[model samples]
Target: MSQNSLRVVWVYPDLLSTYGDQGNVLVLERRARQRRLDVQRVDIRSDQPIPTSGDIYLIGGGEDRPQRLAAERLRRDGGLNRAVANGAIVFSVCAGYQILGHEFINDLGQREQGLGLLDVISTRGEGERCVGDVLADIDDRLGLPPLTGFENHQGITHVGPNARPFARTRIGKGNGTGDGTEGAYNDTVFGTYMHGPVMARNPHISDLLIKLALDVNALPPVDDRWYEALRNERIAAATQPS
Candidate 1:
C-alpha cells in the first residue's frame, strides 16, 4: 500500500524466462532493496493461481510453445487482466510481450489468442529474424533514460491507436520492421521486445515502474552512474557499423 512495502508477481517463470528475462525480476528486487523498500516476489507457475493484487506483474520471453502455453494458462487463470484493470504495473518482454497483445502468430503460423491487455497485434514475419542490439529513446514524459537491449524475435508487432509506443528506436530494427518506433504502452501495461533483461540495462525504467507500483510520485535515489555508463557504452556500440 505504501512505498515502504511492495509485492511483485513473476508470471510463469519456468515458461516465460528465456533470454535471462528473470534478471528483470532480480533488478527490481535489487533496486527496491537499494532504496530500502521492502519487496516480495511471488512466482506464479502454469498450474498456480495468479494473485490478483500484486503491485507489479512481470512476464518475460519464451519459446513459441511455452509462449502459447503461458498465454493459455493465464487466460484460464484469469487474474492478470483484473490486476491490470486495477492499476497494477505490468511489464512483459518478447514472447511475453506478444502474448499481452490482441493476438500473436505461433511458429506453426497459427493465430493464438492473447490477453488483450494491449491494443497491439503480433504476426509472424516471413523473412530473417530480427536479432541485434537495440537502442531506443524513451518517451520524454516518462523522465527515463534511453533504453538499451538485445532484440531477437520474428514476430512483428503493430501497435493500435489505443496504445502508444513506449519508445522510438534509435538503432537496430524494432518490432521487426526497422521502424522508428518500439514497444507498446497503455496506462500501467508495458510490452516490449527488448531482451537484455531490459530492466537490468535500463534501471530508470525499473525505478519508474516501482514508483508506479507504489503509486508514488518519486522514490529514493540509488547510485546509477555505473548503469548509465554501461548503457551509453552499449548504445554507442550498437550504433557502430560492423
Candidate 2:
C-alpha cells in the first residue's frame, strides 16, 4: 500500500454493467494518472474471490436477475464488508445502489435480500421508468461541484436516518419519485441512481473518491475547463423549460 499506488476493485462488471458503468472506473484511473498516482484495477467476477481490501470499489447497474445474483455473491464473499470497514471508498450506481440496501423489489414484484451495506431500501414504481438527465447539488462541505448525470431506474429508494442523501436533485426523478433528493451516503460508501457512469461527467466526484482512497484532504489540480463547459451546457439543456 504505497502512497502513490491505488487499488480499485471493479465489483461484478459482468453482472452489473448494463449502463456502461465500467466508464466510471476509467474516469478514476485517468484522474489518478493525471495526479501522478498509480492505479491498479481489479475486476471481481462471479467466479472469482473478492479481494479483502482495496482503496476503492465500484459497482454498476444491472438487470433484475443479475442484480439479485450479484448481491447474493457479494454477501457470501464477505470481502466487500471488510474493505468497507477498513475505510475503502465505494461508489455504486443504479441497480448496484439498490443491491447495497437491505432489500430491493425485483421486476417480478418479489422482494429480494440485498447486501445490506447501506441503510436504504428500494421498491419498484408503478408508472413510467424514471429515465433522463439529472442535476443535483453536492454537499457543500465536500467542496465538490454540482452533479450532472443520466439516470434510468424504476426503484424508488428511501434512505434511513443513519445515512444521508448523497445530493439534492434539481431536475429529473431521483430516489423516490424526484423528491429533490438523489442518492444515499454513509461515510465513504456512496449509492446513487445517476448512471451515465456518473464519474465521467462529474470529475469532482471522482476526485473526492480519490481523496478518500488516498487518505488525503487535497489532491493536485487538473484542468477540467473543457469538461466543465460541456457539463454546464448539458445541464442548461436539461434544465430548459419543456
Candidate number achieving the greatest TM-score relative to the actual structure? 1
Model 2 segments more than 4 A misplaced = none
Q: Per-residue alpha-carbon lDDT of model 2 for 135-178, expressed as tens digits?
A: 88976667678889898878899989878888888888889655
Q: Model 1: what TM-score?
A: 0.97
- Model 1 per-residue lDDT tens digits across residues 106-208: 7667999999999999998889888999988887878787889999988889989999888999886778755677898987999999998898889887888
Model 1, position 26, has a per-residue lDDT of 94
Worst 10-residue lDDT window for candidate 1 reads: 172-181
Write down the lDDT that model 2 would get.
Answer: 0.87
RMSD of each: 1.1, 1.3
Tell me how far the alpha carbon of residue 171 in candidate 2 is from the true structure, in angstroms, after superposition: 0.6
Worst 10-residue lDDT window for candidate 2 reads 138-147
